[model samples]
Target: MKYNNQRPVVIGVTGGSGSGKTTVSRKIFNELSQNSILILQQDSYYNDQANMTMEQRANVNYDHPLAFDTDLLIEQLSQLLDYKAIEKPVYDYNLLTRGTETIHQEPREVIILEGILILDDARLRDLMDIKVFVDTDDDIRIIRRIQRDTQERGRSLDGIIEQYLNTVKPMYHQFVEPTKRYADIIVPEGGNNQVAIDLLTTKIRSILMQRGNDKIINNKDSTI
Candidate 1:
C-alpha cells in the first residue's frame, strides 16, 4: 500500500522546449499509484504578463530562465515538502498571461515538477530528490513546437519560427543544455522509449517502498 502521510519525493523533469518532458512526466505519472502523485508545470509559474502589453509579451524571451518565477516555485515546492497544499498559478498560452484563477494542489507522496528550465537554478536543484532530462533531436523538438503552438495556442507558423529563432534555440543551448549534467537520468527519444520509462518506474517504486518500510519500522520502535 502507498503511504499517504509520507513526505513527498520531489522529482524535477526538465528539458528543452518541445523535448517531450511533459510526455515523460505523464508516463511516469501514469505508472505511479493513483492519488499518490501530483504533476506541477513550470509553465504555470511564468512571470505574470499583466505589467506588459500584449505586444511586449509577444516579444518576451520565454525560454530563458529569467522568464520563470523561480522564487515562487521554490516556496511552493517547500510547502509540498512540508506536506502542505498550495494554490498554484495558471498561465494562459493564448494570451501569454497568468490567469485570474489558480489551481489548488494537495500534497502527495510524489510531486513531479515538469518544465524546460527547471534545472537552471541551483536552489531549485537542491530541492529535487531526483532530476530527469528528456533529450530529443533539435529538428524534432522544433517541429513539435511549431505544431503545438500553431494548433493549440492559435499561433501562426511564421510567428512560431520567429520566436524559436530569436529565443528558443539560443536559450536551450545557454540555459537548458548545460543543466543536463545535473540530471540523475537522461531519457533519449522522450516518452516513446519504454525501456527508460520502465527503468525509471522501477527506481521510483523502490524508493517509495523503502521509505514506507522505514516509516513503519520507526513507528513500531517508538512504541517499544
Candidate 2:
C-alpha cells in the first residue's frame, strides 16, 4: 500500500536502562499495521569502536549521551522524514562496537524512536511529535538489566552489577531521569500501563487518519 506524501510521525520513547522503553515501543509497533510502522532504536547508534581495543571499548560508558553517534542518527532520521530509505547501523553488544552489516530501512508512516537518552538532545526532541517517558523504579530496572545482560548480551551477573553501579545508575540520575520533565506523557510502570498504551495507540491512529484525509483533499484540489 502506498502511504501518503505526508512526513512520518515521529514518537520518542525514553526511560532509564531496563525501564521497559523497548517493551513500550514494541507494544505500539504491534498495535499499528506492521507495514506502516517502524521502530528505530537509539542503541543502534552507539559510536563505532572498531579501532579501539576490546578493553577500551568495554570501559566506555554505554549509558552516557556521548557514547552515541547522535549526528548520524539525526541525519538518517531526516532522510526517512524526507521519504527516503537509509542504511541503519547495527551494533554488536558482545563486541562493544558497531557490526559490519547494515539494515536497509524504508520510510514508514510512523516511526518510534526508543532509547534511554533520546530526550536529552534538543534536536531529537524537536523532531518528535509526541514524547513519552517510562517511569520504572530503580530496583526493578536493575533486575531487568541483569536479566537482559546475562541472558541476551553474554554478560556476567557480577560485571553487570558493577557496571550498573559505576555508570548506568549515575548517568540515569544525571542525564536520563531529568529529561522526564520534557516528556509529553509520563507512563508509570512502562508497558504494563495498558491504559496509557491504549491512549497512545488511539492518538497515533487518529493522526494517521487525518493525514490520509489531507492527502485526499490535496489530490482533489490538484484536479480542480
Candidate 3:
C-alpha cells in the first residue's frame, strides 16, 4: 500500500536466462547515482537446498517458479518500498547454497527488481511502476548462459547443457515466456539497444524531476 508518497519508484526487469536482463538492469542503474538506486536480483532469492545433497540440489529445476523463495522476496521488496531497511539474502550458485552474511539494504529513490521470473507473479508485478522484459533469441540466450555458467557460476559445460535441455528450456516456455505479455515495455537485444535505453532513461528522469518539482512547490506553499 505504501507508495512514492512514502516509497521509491519500483522497476521490474525480467527475461529468460542469458537474455541480458541483467545488462539492461545494469544500464538503468548506471544512469542513476549510487545512493539513489537499489538493485534486488531475483537469483538472490533462490530457495536454499541445504537439507538436500549436492546431487539432489543439482537436479532442482531452477527455472521453475517453485525454485524461488518468492514469499521472502516479496516481503523484502515490500519492506524496501515501505521506506524500511532489510537484510537482503545472498545465494551462491557455485555452492548452491545461501550465504550466512546478509547485506543491509537501505531504501532508495529507485528500486530495480531484476530476475527471469519477476513478471510471472501478480503480487510482485502489481508493485512495479515500470515493468520491462528483455527479448532475445533462444540460441543467443543459451550460448550466453553456457559461457556465464561455465566461467562465473563454476558449472560444467555438459551440466549446463543438460540442465538447459531438461528444465530451463521447458520452464521458460511454461512460465517466463508467458509473462512477457504483462510487460509495459519489451526491449529487444537488451542493453545493447541504445534507443530503448535512451527513451527509458528520459522517462525515468522526467518522473524524478516531476517529484522534485512537487516537493519544491509544496515547500513554497508551506512558507506562504
Considering every candidate listed, which one attains the maximal TM-score? Answer: 2
Model 3, span 46-133: residue lDDT tens: 9978898998987788899999999999999999778798998889776787888788887777788999999989999999989999
Q: Each model's TM-score?
A: 0.91, 0.93, 0.90
Candidate number with the higher lDDT (2 or 3): 2
| Cα displacement (Å) at residue 87, model 3 | 0.4
Please provide, for model 2 over 14-79, each residue's C-alpha lDDT reduced to its tens digit, 9 standing for 90 to 100.
999999999999888777643367889999999999999998998899999999999999999999
Which residue pairs clash within candidate 3? none
The models' CA-based lDDT, in order, is: 0.84, 0.87, 0.82
> Which candidate, 1 or 3, would have the higher lDDT against the true structure?
1
Ranking by lDDT: 2, 1, 3
Better of 1 and 3 by TM-score: 1
Error of 2 at 107 (Å): 0.5
State the weakest 10-residue window (summed lDDT) of model 2: 215-224
Best by lDDT: 2
